[model samples]
Target: MINLKMILRIMGILSLIEAVLLLLCAGVSLIYGESIINDFLMVAAGSVIFGGLLLLMGKGASKQLNRRNGYLIVTLSWLLFSAIGMFPFLISGYVPRVVDAFFETMSGFTTTGATVIDNIESLPHGLLFWRSLTQWAGGLGIIFFTIAMLPLFGMGSMHLFSAEATGTSHERLHPRISITAKWIWYVYFGLTLALTLFLLLGGMNLFDSICHSFSTISTGGFSTKKASIAYYSSPYIEYVISIFMILSGINFTLFFYLAKGKPQKALLNEELKWFLKSIIVFTAIFTVTLTYTSPYGVGESFRKALFQVASLHTTTGLVSADYMVWTPFLWALLGVIMFLGASSGCTSGAIKSIRLLILGKMTKNEFKRMVHPNAVLPVKINKIAISPSTQSSVLLFILLYMIIFVASWLAMMAMGVGNVEAFGTVVSSMGSVGPGLGLCGPVHSWNCLPDGGKWLLSFLMLIGRLELFTVLLLFTPQFWKKR
Candidate 1:
């Protein structure tokens, strides 16, 4: 019932591609003369051998995959990807521990930007490139990238696409899902390229520009320097990255609309409207808070607030300053934005804004329904009526997200972590918004977290990246029942 052969075959392909990406990183290491080249090659070789074996064993599985298979494969590939990707850190003795390496790689692939390494600058060029590369691959999603580029995966492409993509906000922009995938990728890569050029123009070096652009456009927060965006201390660079972070958080389809000269349609998108408004609202509030307390001038405070707010709003972990240094209230406010991540169809993680919009509408509709029992009232997003079933799913997702958040918080607290760290870590990790308050706040690495906390947060990153259902559904008895 599970399509084990098909799963293995597809996983093989995923691994092969992963190996190829690693080899590219190895090339960077070779050029930079980093000693980590051997670690990268060893893992790539292992990936190749294992992938070839899986392909050979599952030759019969080269068929169209069912919806169920898509879900399983997507979930399995993420797990396997993280599991294999950790080796460079482990084998190189950079991370030393399997759990630490796994946590780092998982955070990267999930684009969560949480790091266990205490000193990122000391890492060699190759390892740094690999670090940035993970987020780049993860930004749009590794499987999503595979489906778009590899024609062999055309069967069930939509199933894989839907299973892996975020939100129900937008459907295929193109009639053919593969075409839609390519178009989506064009926008993704185009944005990355444009952002790289912008950063280069802002005086960033080529390497930092490309690396930061990869993270920025993907909304993955991995930064090349220890101080993140703060390392540059250039207002121009900060503003450029801030703008792109906001742009990246937008649904990619909206870009497709703009490119197709449907700017009016894209501008009319309800989620886009809400997203822009939310950014403005958050930026204003955060700026006001900083202005009231921070020693910096009003303009500087607003700039800092805008950059940090955009970073957190998009779930990009790049920080312009140490947020923990801010007032506790402001720090808590950042946590709130972390919970309500960017637009649904983008890379940033969390409950997503579309659901928040839906929740707001649902709450208003409930009050209206209460006032007039017999009157017909419908909830609509972008003028399209939302069905009762869709509302139920959204409601359930929020409820489940909260439950898991609380459970993770409790679990971390139980592990002897402080309240602030536990709360911030759980919410940030569960939301896939790296950086939290107190000990785990901006400017803090996860090196201090206990082993259990690392593993727990790693799983949280995976589930958060998958948007919960794909991973959570595996535990349901119904998921295993054969039709």
Candidate 2:
């Protein structure tokens, strides 16, 4: 049987920690003299009470976690945390509808960068801050955060850490999973703080600066202004964001390597090299095309090309120019970028570059096999041959991803969205890339989406963020069967 007691204890602790964070938001409300302080207080109190009950009831539970309990805890933790996280928006009456509030909260936690809220500036400073904080929390992952800070999990922390951490490859910078989690958090925080300082220095107010920094580091594209980065109209702000978006998309494990004085090893990573190469290649193509095709100056064209490439490639989704209005070729270019996401083990979503790289190598070997017949040609990564099982897993993942995309596209079309819009929105949501090509394009928000469509896309956002397998594995009968 699963250790429900232990799972509940972990969830309870996480809830408690979340409630404490809510209180900090409440503190922000008090400082700003915002009318939503009462709302924050109410939400904080509710979280505390709910969390307190779980802690009290599960106090006698065992501390250890196994595979079953780890999956159960991680899945339930996100759902419950999202549910609790919605209270601020609900209580504040900023987003009165339960579905909309839940969608916003889920988007925030998933770092999906999609928003239903049409008027962002009208939201209270405290609520906005909480929204940004949710992205930061979800960016590093709440479960991993708990594993790092809470010591009660003991050796079992590895189970929870593996479940929460993105990517097929797990590299530990420290001997213990807890220490590894802490180190990653340290790097995440450092980057976020640095971005915030730069944004502040670039003429944004403290609130917008902090919020944008949170979103940037998370690769979550929630913006304080309606026009996003375009609202600033400052090339400096855009430049800072462009750089950080790329950085956020790279694997933090590589960051740990660089931090540990192994910059050469980090640079030698095949995925990182291919990732940069892809960016440069695509950026150059788009810049030249846009410059020649459009009336915009060379400098303006280059800026737009870099921003859009960085945005879609990193899955950051921050837009300065409306690609919908740009040449049709540029729009197609972004769609391609949307499908090829950031490096593995990072916060960015979609079919990761590492998987694609493996697939490319595998394809080449298969071609070689056809000609060589009996000769052995193994697929290699980092100068090491990949096992058949790993190759099988990557291929299967890609197949399933494509299947999901087609199904979602069909479903959205049936939901009354136009063919172009449906395909764009489905791919965007499923890839966690935020913007689509048509109605859901960079110039438009998902606000106009039907309720059914919003709910569908929200579910897709969660699925994509968890990487299809983790969430889909729950549906298997074997996953639920008794041991």
lDDT of 1 by residue, 226-330 (tens): 889999989999889889999999988888788889899899988888888999988888888888888987888888999999999889889999988888888
Candidate 2: 10-residue stretch with minimal lDDT: 149-158
For model 2, the superposed segments whose C-alpha errors exceed 4 Å read 152-155
lDDT of 2: 0.84
* Clash tally, candidates in order: 0, 0
The true-versus-predicted C-alpha distance at residue 443 of model 1, in Å, is 0.6
For each candidate, give its TM-score against the true structure.
Answer: 0.98, 0.97
Q: Which candidate number would show the highest lDDT if scored against the true structure?
A: 1
Give the winner by TM-score. Answer: 1
**Candidate 2 residue pairs in clash (backbone atoms < 3 Å):** none
